[model samples]
Target: MRHPHPLPPPGHAEVRIVAATPEAARLIAEALRRRFAATEQRSYPAGGEGGTRLHLTVDTTHTAAAPRPWPATGEASGARRLQADEI
Candidate 1:
């Protein structure tokens, strides 16, 4: 049997969006534009012998880059638990 494609890491993802109306599809594509390198929407004829149908395909994919070095030369800085009185 065929297996589904596995997802990437937490910072990486792929999305395939399909909508009947242009407006609805555009809204989805716009919202996710920043998270992906490219968002492409296209029209295609429906499978039938009669009239054509309107459909939108919004396909986008994102891949995370390699980890970068810390900016500072000192030890790492992180948050610490505060005392009850501090709260």
Candidate 2:
């Protein structure tokens, strides 16, 4: 079963994109909006600087499906395990 909140424990994944212009950033943001369904984008001026920064947030809980292999274990399981050798 999947919880109402389907998220990894808590960490960050960094991504790099080639968005050299405002139009390119808008296009990239639009593409992400379609893919994630629930997404929000905002732009704000930084301090006294003349440049604007874009912020994006995505919520995937509603679309995430239930997990398979209820109790993951053993060799055939999809979960990762720490072997004695590694320990």
Candidate 3:
């Protein structure tokens, strides 16, 4: 039989990465591979406008390495921490 909606198996997660460029989407997928057991990424056009969409299936039960923490506000990484109001 066929189902309109399907779910990933237990301990597995489906991740979709959308970015302005294919390179950006690929980079994000690579980063996720470093943290989890993930399948090779599959990419496709996002919409009428130019954009990239990458899909990956990751095994949450396994960890390749300890997850890195997001950079704190004003850190050298140049990522600004969002305040509650901004969210």
List residue ranges in candidate 2 displaced over 4 A: 1-18, 45-52, 63-87
Top candidate when judged by TM-score against the true structure: 3
**Root-mean-square deviation per candidate:** 13.8, 14.6, 6.8
Quick one: best lDDT, which candidate?
A: 3
lDDT tens per residue, model 2, 24-75:
5667666555545434567665445454455665545443334345354456
lDDT of 1 by residue, 41-84 (tens): 55444345332333222233342233456545455434455557
Itemize residue pairs with steric clashes in candidate 2: none
Poorest lDDT segment (10 consecutive residues) of candidate 3: 71-80
Per-residue lDDT value at 79 in model 3: 60
lDDT of 2: 0.51
lDDT of 3 by residue, 30-83 (tens): 889999999989999999879999999999999988998976554763366768
**TM-score ranking of the models:** 3, 2, 1
TM-score of each: 0.34, 0.38, 0.74
Worst 10 residues of 1 by lDDT: 50-59
